[model samples]
Target: MMKLLRLCALLICMSNAWLLQAQTTDSISKIDSLRIKQIIQSGSTGKEDNNRNVLLNAANNTSPRDVNIGLPSSVGGITILENDLPVVYFFWPELPTTTWRQSVGLERTGLLKMNQVALTMGDLGFAVNSYSQTGTKEFKFKSRFTTSHYGWLQGDVNVSGPMSKNGWTYSVGAFLNYDPSTYTLGFARNAEEAKIFRAGITKYFDDDRGKITLNYKYTDSYNLVNYALFNYQTNGQVRELDNFRIGRDSYILSDGAVRFKDVRSGEYYMANLTGNEVTSSSHTINLFGNYKLENDWNFKFSTQFRSSKAARILLPPLSIFSTNAPAQSGNTYTIASTGERYEGNVGTQLAMNTPPTPLTTVQGRFSLEKKVDNHFLTFGLLEQFYRVNQFVSNRSFFYQTAEAQPRLLIGPNTDEYGFYGYNLGSEYHNGIENKLSIYANDEWKVNDRFNLNYGLIFRNHIVNGDYSQTPRTPDFTLQNATFTDINYSWYHIGGSANATYNLTRQFGLMADFQYTEQNRQLEGYSLPEPARTNKIRSPLGAFGIFYNNDFIQLISQATFLTRNDYLSRFNLVNPVNASEAVATTTYYDIQTIGWTTDFVLNPFKGFNLHYLITLQNPVYKNFNFEAFGVNYNYSDNNVLGVSKVLMEIDPSYEYKKWKVWASFRYFSDQFANLTNVLYFAPRWETFGGVSYKLNKNIDLNGRVINFLNQRGASGTVNGAELVTDASLYENRLLTGSYMMPFTVQFSVGINF
Candidate 1:
């Protein structure tokens, strides 16, 4: 409550300051209204041209596969933001619903609307505008329906028009999606669903110097949580079981269910895995305005408030062990349901349930820009506040591993709680965070052939939180616990410099450098002993050359990035005793050296090709930690789940009324463990699509994903973090995620 009052006070102060500044500015001549209108229209389009940033390559123009996660492109070898503040208030443990990306009048790249070039892991300080359209009075209606082969259906409708001739406009959009799992799992099919709605209204001033927009969005969604199991081969490869297809079968049981204890209340509950899925919902509102001030100064401000309840439920595979091995009581395992002896491998899975975490967030940004002779300057302030009430619980179960569908198993002493295995624990966290930053940027055109840009930022971050954990007793019942307060604060100062020099009419050289220092996030506070409050330092440098002409455009860049004081939690098993496991929090460092090349070739009038290639060497450094009184080190090990080589080739041909395109992507081998013992082989994915313009208002499209039927696994292997010797269990079973199999999709769209 105190935090809320403080936030309100801060906002009120800022508002008063803005009013004072606007009222004190001297009278000035009216600006070019037509140019201002053009700028507004361009902002709404969400596209940028002639950007020379190495990270903003043409290959990144495609829409992201999952906006909830982030863009597919990575900066400095980190794909996702460390915190959710830059995107959403919170994210689901399993899969969350898409946010602003699905709204009408929004850009594919969220930064485009803000006139930003790119976002990096160390520099995720940006504000997102919801939906605002201005300029000419126009009306548009668009609707699309899509169906995939694996029982996936999606529909989207968007409408925007002038509500009044006197400069009022409105936009409304709805998105619905239902996706079955990639595999043909009978019970868990169609286990994911999402429904999102967005609405916005804009009022443009008659003088065309200012506009105000108000936007609202609501989202409700749920997703299935399951992965595939594989067998590790002696040759550092993975293979499917005899009866189980790698990408065609699921390990989830038809009658799967979980029993867990609620963290808030000391009550136990049985959650059915079928129709009673955990659902999540969120509501967000945004108010934004921009105006042309005196003396050619432009002012922009936006504020967003959101409230959400995020829920998570998943059955994740933990570890695999031979059922023939002696149990804690020197007895073999048996089927709990059928009372039959089990002789094969058995996999331990965890039933994790995080019931509806309530969260509230408020974000605001204010900026002023002015153009001077040969230089453009911008000053901005960003503030964010969020509070989260979180709770999570985990219960363990045992299943006899099989070629196809696995069967539940139990030992001689099944727990009194009716669990096949023991209960892990339940945890509760109540936290609030506040962040404020002040920044300034300048773009200088030194000459026609040379340009320079730079920015500096200073931030103060504070987190106040309380955490508690309830452990299971000998009888598998949860024990009562009391919360402990945890508070911390950190300061950050970061800067970036970029320069471009034109060598010739069609060629240019560009270079950039960025550095940041800040403390780790609140995720580390839940540990038994809170993680060290160390500052994380990140540095990135890049140099690139580009050539542009009528027929071809090419950019090749090289980058070097290093990050220190990285913290993470890993579940490690004792090498000597497979059953002895512990979750430990550790710190490490990462270094990456990479090269990327992108090409857009239009050799002829009707054909175009977009080719991109990336090569990177990312490694761990000083990665030493202790767990269970044992010391371990993984220094200089290759990072897991990051391929050294990646390539994509996309080509399209456009005829009078028809267009066809195909994309081919390749990924080199990648390690699956920090020890670099287990790895997956190279893989290829192919996609092709054809679109027909039926008329001015209608279009039809069809696409095929994974047309080559590639069957390969991706993602880190569960419970393999401590496996330093691959030969110890060459033929043992492991679990991880797999690539989706071949699928077809068809869509029809109507636009007016």
Candidate 2:
């Protein structure tokens, strides 16, 4: 068994280092021992070094490790390694920033509907670090610029080097970004712009034992536009739905026709309105430090402070009425109706000088890590403090078509029903939380033929808070009601355990188990209900086996998850068959089981292929919940937005200076909502691109994304505004994320 293991390791090392012509025997001996150690433990390291190189100008002596051993980098890149008899050479140019990694990966290969346009922007950045005197005094610097066709731009510069001859190192970095194409759900006359600024400074002590960093950032962003309901006559004429009839006789079927109902159905339409401009700003300061202690121990500490202010504005996207139209006009539709619409009144209006929301927070963390022989230990503590205050008023106007009910009028002379008006309200909160965690792991070599790894983490979290809010009343006056104060406290414990064992030279087995609990306090908006604790418990376990060789690898895993006390969103609905909406809370239990298989093949030089498939079954188990004072059952139903099957394939080929690659993804049909009122059909997508390295420091690339341009009904959404009967008063249009059309993009950059 020992001989077999040594042979397998030797074959893998030879194929990766010598077969690729990456390093000669003499050069391989000169390679840093640290680099070789990382490669042997992780199987891959140079690819991750590319991403780490982009984060700052200073190049780390050790390469970063990959999160998932066999997965591709979030941002695509190419790597080349070569070592002569005296010098080692490596180049990895295509690196994605922290932000671009998430956005770009999803745009090109994500399965769900997403804002592809917002995420499709391309970036170009590179850096080089050289160590003189055999890795003693390193000097490095970098520059980057990114832009999109939609009026977005980002640029940054970073530098790092020895500050003095006394063994002190320093790094400086700054960045500026402007984006005028921030997308909004609704239409806007002028697109809102977002601006950001960031700067950081770091100092390293002698012998690389300790380091400190200070960073500052500021951001300003805008919200989306607003929409409203309108009344458009069949003659292509449009008018605002602002006026209502006082009696049944005041409305007629047509112009001069006999009056039968009090309202008209065919006249209602919807239109986008220029929403008020709302801007939010945040300022943050961060200070961090790390120190290495004796006996292979390490210590880390960090603190962060943030201040944020929001514009004095109402959430205009949530209008009084929904986008859906009604089924029946006043007369039970003597005339054919267009469809159901969500219109509460002729028009919805906002009050000026709404209170702005202000927030301040402070966060701190401390951790220590130590390694004693084959055992590793870690402990950490975290603390957070937060404060928030806000006052707001949203005035919705509805001409009283029906007689004014008890205290329905806003004023004595006013004959309007503010059915959707959220009267003067305020929220004040002061919250704090503390958490402590400890973890230990062991890597044991039981024998020449067997290796084992096991670990576990234990954590506790405690939270306390004081919150208050004003109840609603008639006249939309704050003085009419008093503030209601509430206090909350909770504690929770969580843990995880994992184990891995080697069965043979090329075979391995692994198992992992996790248990978590959380106590959350839900904010209250209604008078009867104050903030309440929402307890959640989630437990998960997984078992897997894998076979790895020099040229091919295969892994299969099965996972089971159970959520015992899951909290749902706070739903607002009209339970009394009224036009107003009331809030309610719901909870459920869910269970899921999933199986995943991954395959990687490198049958020949300069060619690679990867395939992954996942089969999952998620359902609402023993789900019984209440909404608007009514109980409902939803046991054994498939979870919304969770597909039964998902698949992906990635293939790439490289020869000489040219590289070509393609990505394919597929998702099975799934339900859009819990009620199963709408469903989405299966979708398949393809993306292909080509890259050419003109030279070591320069490259050009082009991609044709969304090649299939698959388009159809993606999914559906309930009306923005909840009503008594959704079928009678809600719109039924599928409103999930829309697929991006076929697009072509090109990028070129240099690394020196």
Candidate 3:
């Protein structure tokens, strides 16, 4: 803690000194509009750099999250969009893990476009376009090879040029990535691996004002699921284990395979934990075009068709207890395939697997825009269709707890089916979803000192599906079950209004308000009888002031947001006994009021500093649920996985052909569970890098992640939902995820 404080103080002192010196200098001038736009778009004053694009958007003051790694990201506590379209798969608004990683390769992207508006008229009005074309005619070729300290290697090659003299352009790229986990696992060769290929062709017409492009992408990926287990005190302080390093050791077993019946088919099969990996694949095609019309009018259209398959294989810990506990007697725990008693701390884990499930989707959008006087108006339509066939099977297994490489165990209660208890063949879902949206927006310049923007949107959502699940009963068996039909529909209307007033050439004031309505998602259809509740409503309001100069630029804003009717599901275990558990669904609401400030300081020549700070109170309201035939109310609890404060400071210096930069991010304490009793301490994630432009066609770069080596846990605590009271769980064991350890990466880039 002291070290972190000292670092913060040092940075602040340096910034103040630089600011004073810059103010007294006679070389400073007013910042130009082009430079301001660059800062707003890339979060830096210098040329675009992938390493500096850490914050998703400077306006919201939030960072991007990796959905593949079980992290959820939001813009002002709301779901974000991709290319002005919702990225929904099943119930969540996140694309399949492999699809995102493959489509957005490390070195394939030529440009990143972001549109942020304080309105709900355009599908959240905050979207990121990551797949824009290069639009280059001259020959261009680029390749990069990167190696990490942990023996991971990644590489990509891209080339684009004119296919023919008759206005045809083409591009092709390939990427390969291999990443072992932060901690090496004895049972797996690599924790994550991926291969991606992309190709595109474009034809220009009407002097480049009109063009059509067709693109194809393919991705194959594999990943391993793992986490860390530790003990915690009543005060929410984590306890270190004797032989296990929190961020440098893994507890997955080498011989943890299990036999289980398929959810859709009754045939039995053995699922291996070693050598074999969970794999997924995807194929995507995109067709898009835009044309400029006469009389200041324009037209644009885009369409996509995708067929993909996703695989799931997880061994999530449910509970941990001592061997001498009351629940371990009477031959309750024994060595796997044997009758010998097992002695040690034991962890109950759910071995869950789902065969590669098929998914197909088609989406299209069309828009028209016109400019009249000081007003710019746009009208658009969007349509999407998705189909998914999924099946999941689960079995319970016991393992002796250790710092690394545990051994599986079986109990007398284990049935002939090779599972200890409950939910043998878990779930099956076959579903189809359709969405249609119509929206219109207008931007008007009221005067030289005043501007106004407003928009309205309407959306229709529909779902049709068949679902079934096994009952959570002891000694359950895989039974042939029939599926149930599910049919539902919803209508939504939303809009926003925004205004900005420039008081002077260097200062401005702005305010905006937005509102939207949400409905039940398709994932809820898996239940035999889905819950019927009021439409979830979300409302947001913001007010801010901005100032810009040659030495520094700043924007400070205060925002209030409220969202209700949230739905979630969890499987909780009895703390006293590892054999007993319950599956539950919960409904809740959240309200938050936050303040955010973004700063871009060019205090001296060739030196730039970008800083952002966010402080917010995101708390639950009317959070009530039922489990074990008991009602639990946790109103006024802090929202899980959300910190009250977030800060990012990045500073870079450029001199001739050499550039150096560092980024420091700090997250305050966050609640780890619904009860708000378990929490993770504050932590810092620091990164530093240096690059040398060795001639115009070659570059050398080196980067270090977690350079400060702060080894702390992140994400939510596993299976702690039943611990509503903290006093009873003092000194009890807990299982959760840990941050990545320190590592270094070096890369060589070649371009011609």
Report the C-alpha lDDT of model 3 over 1-752, residue by residue, as the tens digit: 35323433543354344334333331232000001111221112111224334332211111233211001233122232333333334422113445544232332321221113323233332223345343347888878888877777878788888988887888788888887756667667677777878788877765656766677878787666667767776665677677677766777765546665554555566776542325777787766666676555676666666667666567777777777766565555666546566777777777766667666666766677787887888888777777675544444454555446676666555565436554442545566777777878787777777777778878888877766644544334436455566687889877877676778877888776777876775666444445553688877777888778788887777877777876665677765555677667677887777777778899899999988777877777888987766778888887777777777789999999999998887778878887787788887778889999999999999988788887667767787866767776677777787766787879899989
Clashes of each: 0, 8, 0
- lDDT comparing candidate 1 with the true structure: 0.62
Poorest lDDT segment (10 consecutive residues) of candidate 1: 29-38
The TM-score, computed over Cα atoms with residue i paired to residue i, of candidate 3 is 0.85
Q: Arrange candidates by lDDT, descending.
A: 3, 1, 2
Q: Better model by lDDT, 1 or 2?
A: 1
lDDT of 2 at 111: 15
Candidate 1: list runs displaced more than 4 Å: 1-85, 90-136, 186-188, 274-277, 325-341, 393-397, 400-405, 412-427, 468-479
Q: With candidate 2 superimposed using the best TM-score fit, by how many Å does residue 401's alpha carbon deviate from the native?
A: 22
- The collision pairs in model 2 are 241-346, 324-341, 324-342, 324-731, 325-340, 325-341, 326-340, 326-341
With a 3 Å backbone cut-off (N, CA, C), the pairs that clash in candidate 3 are none
Q: List model 1 lDDT by residue over 468-558, tens digit each.
A: 5434432234245655777988898887777767788778887767777777555555544555677777676778887778998777778
